[model samples]
Target: MNEDELFEALKATLLKEDREALQRLQDILDQPEKLSQKMSPVLEERLATFKQAFPKEYKGIIEKIISEKLANSKEELLEAIYPIMGKLIKKYTALQFQLLQERIDQKLKFGIWHRIKTGFRSFFFGVKEDEMILNELMSSTIDNIFIIQKHSGLLIASTNNNPAHQDDLLAGMMTAIKSFAEDAFDKNGAELEVITYDNYQLLLESYYSYYFVVAVNGNISSHQSAVIHEKMNNFSAKYLSRDKVKSGQFSQALSINLKSYFFTNPIA
Candidate 1:
């Protein structure tokens, strides 16, 4: 065999092997499953590296873009949320109103029950309804009672045994305060009925000849006030007379009677 012929045969053999190898490579590319099997691990490794790096590299950029978009849409966002806020407020107000109504209903129901119980007690126990209510709800003490001449400010009679001068001074002060109140609001021409300070109350009752001032301490209910007024009226009718006014002083017997009427029992 010649050298050129041997070389050509050797090159042809190498080319055939190369062609077979190339055909095998083309088959792998044509088959999708084979291609994916070869590339999947490499692609997964690259994806994992990207995921780890993306937060460190691109996080700031993404946040800035979102913030800018929100800032630009602020007005639109408020417009969307305003209705929701109004609904929440309305719901809260409705709930509060319902709770208040429930409380009022409870009080009214309690009041009805109380009235029924009071009626039963009055019918069976011979206790006056209003008097019973005052006994339970009111507490008070009558400290002093004074009868003073209306215009002249003369101390006619007193429950206090203090000197006549102190009684006269107290009478003058009360007269002056009454005059001031009447004069200050003369348009209504209303008489001064009460003067209160802290837990003390001075109840005043006016008559044609004189007025009375009763010093009271502690809680006063309307029923208790009515009872006190009625008691004062009775006292005035029974004790006050022409001779009593002319004397302008409390006799020892009169003083004892006054104390017995007011101080012996509670106002009820």
Candidate 2:
């Protein structure tokens, strides 16, 4: 055996072992279940080790890679993240709305303590107690009053301080807004009570045949709201008969009566 022959013989032996190993690997690869069984333990071990060392070993690398990708493909990254961002924004907006509603509820909750405190302050200070209480609790004024036909959205009667008021247009608009709000919220027989804008508010009191829409200019306390509601009930009971209202028999007499009633006892 010379040098070349000896090298060739060693190469052949190695080649045979390599072929046998390759054949065994190919066989394992062909059978998916067996391959999974063999690979699972090794993969699990590797993953465990990676998880253990990830913070120390790969954290900086991952951050750098992400930073680089973001820097290089800013628009692409934003596009990918846009949907998630929108969903997050919508969720945040909804949460904010709920928080606002809760805050309003808190402000509106006039407990016994509040009444007592207000009463005591009024008694001691010798100020106009009723006015002071109204100021402290809620300084509201009725800007416009409307008695609207429910299904027809007809203007039964209305009164407002504004001389430039468009009664028919305002009535239609108010009815549309009320309808939209009720349908959108789907409150299951609950009426849309308050519609608020910058420094203005509309308080709605719904009834069977007709509804009362009172536009107010400030915060209305619970007591004040109840008083107004009671007044409305009285008005309805005394003047607006359901049959008459439904039959479109709301005459000028009834309108004049409504105007007189509200004007005589104005809500401040």
RMSD of each: 31.3, 20.6
Error of 2 at 48 (Å): 97
lDDT of 2 by residue, 146-202 (tens): 888876788787775454797657877888988888888887866777788987878
Kindly list the per-residue Cα lDDT of model 1 for residues 148-265, writing each as its tens digit: 7777777777777767548778988999999889899886746787899988999887655567788988877654565666666667766765446554554656667777777776
* Model 1 weakest 10-residue run by lDDT: 78-87
lDDT of 2: 0.71
Clashes of 1: 0
Q: Which stretches of model 1 miss by more than 4 angstroms? A: 1-137, 162-165, 187-189, 246-253
TM-score per model over all chains:
0.47, 0.50
Best by lDDT: 1
lDDT values of the candidates?
A: 0.73, 0.71
Best by TM-score: 2
lDDT (0-100) at residue 95 of candidate 1?
A: 66
